[model samples]
Target: MRFLAFLLFIAFVLFAIFARWFFICDILNLCEEAPVEVEVAPRLQTLQLTENDSVLLSGYDQFAFSKGIDQPELNTNNEQFLDTLAQMLTADTTKSLEITGRFTPQEKDIMAGFYENMGLARAAAIRDLMASRGIDENRISLKHAITSDSLLQEPLLFAFALNDLPSEYATASYRFTNMTYSDANFPSNSAIFDPGEAFRNYADSVKVYMEAHPEKSIRIVGHTDNIDSEKYNLKLGMRRAESAKEYLENLGITSAIETESKGETEHVASNDTPEGRQENRRVNFIIE
Candidate 1:
């Protein structure tokens, strides 16, 4: 009986020692396992806009409309502007016009639905004028004003710009010729490609494209969100482009590959939203 009691005491002492050691290690975080890396879901790809086609037509002093009326009458001075705009739109059949209206916040509240209706009405009026001038009505797109940073003292401030090629064309071109990938393909704040399936698939696609187009050279352009200083982002962007270029080279692509960094200069979407930021942080390939 005495030997049995001693054994039971020894067992209890060993259990107490282990429990105390485990408690100490847990308190010190020494028993914690390394965090498992979670894979990020692939973002939906969209057709990229052509860089050179974007033009801003604004800052007109003569463009104004009546308070109750949405139809904008171009003054003699503004007629020349309108003529130039119409010429540009008619110059390219693949190009389309995007019209955006601006209104003061106070005016928006005072006029209520008038603010929204006026914007669309003015856009429609512009479309009709352009159509009358021989431009295709189907090529014009109107987007209502969502928000304005400052109040426009003028009757209304409007901007007209050209859209890129149609979505069908752009999408087709992207699938066949260009490969676009986002920052999610890389580790956080790293130029190294993450060991993810999305990145590997992108690499495979690029390898196939290069094999199919031996005569064409590729330009890798990297861009980043407006999260850091321009200089820092520029360097980061270049590193990312270099990383991609290196990956391609390893894939046995012997064609010439050039890398460029635009930093935070050209943003595809507003940086205020998470999705927009994600869209901004991307690398594009231009096959020449």
Candidate 2:
């Protein structure tokens, strides 16, 4: 028995040495291999901007100049355009504006940074003007692109599109007719969904609509009353939205659903009254 034990110990040591020398070191490709050459596609060769039906600022000759928009140089046309944009934005709280700066292909090499900077500056200038005219700054987005089309004489183009929905969805005639649940439907300071029959019916209706229209997307926006700090309210609002999203997902609604928290910033009612505060803590479903 002792001789057998000694032989077993020797076999174990030999196996360990073999493992370290051959299996660990040689069998496993621990050594660095030669680097491989990969083919990469060239960028800036194609123009990504597409022509859309929604045109807010079209053929504005003022933006054609290389210099940024000067406040003094804004002519009657510019002022009228700004006024109309501000009015449109004021009328629709869900609408947002996008400004794109398009540069000619010839100028791409000479003024790459200039085109980008000018695009942002132009959008910022327009946003500032709109803000001065009583439109919120958060309702605007800015982008820059280089277009090979020489026909685009204007350096900047403005388009007004829905904030949450794609342009195609926005133009569709279908409307979401279901009424949203009020704050009373949910438990106090909780995001858990203990749905009554009415709430379940509403969710079913939304699910049916979404299943029929797979292309459409919905945004569940949650709002809270001004009871706590803005940070706490924001988190609570997000939780509420998430709760709604989970409920909808469980209902087999296959369409894309997103959640947003407005906190106490976008209140539907005055926070002074108890009734008003209750009304403020609600969720809104925006179909896109």
Candidate 3:
């Protein structure tokens, strides 16, 4: 019995030794196995997103529906819409757009505390644009930028996505003929001036929206589209900017409005193409 017990103890020692060796070998293998690439967190490459890429289309309901106007029928005799776009394009554009603070019922539409205000503000802007296009001055129209969640979830049931409606007209259906921003050759100015003159009902709408807010102030700047000398562009930019300013001033808003010109320096678009050049020659507003 003692001999058997001694033999068992010897076997236990060998087993223990083999177990230690196995664990040591495993530890060594783990260290050699590609070092587990302690992955440093990947650096984030930042990029900018602008208004053009946004998919939220809420603004104009009638215009988004079958009744939505892509472009107004050119007033053949007056060409009011084209002329309006032109004036808007020529207006100074150094300033970024501004919207006045508003009295709110306390809901936002974007990333909280801003989404509703922003959406309502945009809708108000569309209303102002329609007004610029000749709505009855005494009557004010109101609509919600929001729709029933059911409308969004079951678009077929609601028959339309409210955002699909345009705010004034389809931006896709523009009616202007000449959109160049050069002093080398200017097109004949229309006999009568359109308040917007070019693609600027948007700007005017913003101005009008600010004015509607009553407590807020607004300012605007203009710039050229790089079709001429910077000096000439600046001066030209001022004329159109002042023109817009004066128009707003005449709307019984004398003091809170300001205007200036920035020539061709602060362009939001490239001046390489006719389309882009048209975009660059413009005006914008700042609000407080």
Candidate 4:
């Protein structure tokens, strides 16, 4: 029995020496496993406003959304970053934010109520979050883009600008055109001018011209349809012109702006039809 016990002990020792490696390498398969790669998080890029002006948002990555989700999943650091942005906006009243959300074509497009697509909805969601953090909603605009990159790491992009939208209507030579006031342009019988994307281009050109030739001045001639009395139309037209002038001035134009009212006398279209009347109610910007 003692010899049998000694034999068992020998067997146990042999098992521990020989079987241990096989247990780890063959049974567990740990020896065949490859080294896991650590993924580095993407850093948030700086927001460039101009040649000299830029906003550096350190320690924050771009916000990302889940598949088919409009709301972004923001982290604690993201909240802090937004707080800092809100404070910056509060201090500087002349700056605005443009949030552009990007999406892939392969993803299903989901409409979030008024937003036509998930791209726009994502942008609006971020804008609303910023607005909730004390930034004025009006100061924030939303844009969306479709990307072919299905592997886009981060989906949202941000742009900080000088409180003005980039105009696409810039021209080499200046041509004075009608700043139409109608359903398509401004509210009926109101001085409020909601400048379209095209109009913004013209406004930008005006600024460039004023900067290049400081001696040049602008003349805004306001015209109206024959819906109102002559005196009332004249007043309305003058108000329209003044509104345009004020808009240009806010765009950093320092040149003098003279506003006048042509009333219903200069009707480019007939006032008989709705479309013609709409066409007639406009202001012309003449550079002098």
Give per-residue CA lDDT, model 1, range 22-78, as digits (tens): 887877656667899997433222212222454345444445654445677566656
Better of 1 and 3 by lDDT: 1
TM-score of each: 0.42, 0.39, 0.34, 0.42
Residue-wise lDDT of candidate 4 within 48-101, one digit each (tens)? 222125545643666767777888778776677678878878998887776777
**Candidate 4 or 2, higher lDDT:** 4
Backbone clashes in candidate 2 total: 0
Model 2: ten consecutive residues of lowest lDDT: 167-176
Error of 4 at 286 (Å): 28
Error of 4 at 80 (Å): 1.6
The TM-score that candidate 2 achieves is 0.39
| Per-residue lDDT of candidate 2, residues 151-268 (tens digit) | 4445556776667674311110111342344575578778876666545656777788887888889998888889999999999898998998888888888888899998888775
For model 2, the superposed segments whose C-alpha errors exceed 4 Å read 1-179
How many backbone clashes are present in model 3?
Answer: 27
- Say which prediction, candidate 2 or candidate 3, comes out ahead on TM-score: 2
User: Which stretch of 10 consecutive residues in model 1 shows the poorest summed lDDT?
Assistant: 167-176
CA lDDT of every candidate? 0.62, 0.63, 0.40, 0.69
* Counted clashes in each candidate structure: 0, 0, 27, 0
User: Local error of candidate 2 at 285, Å?
Assistant: 1.1
Per-residue lDDT of 183 in model 2: 71
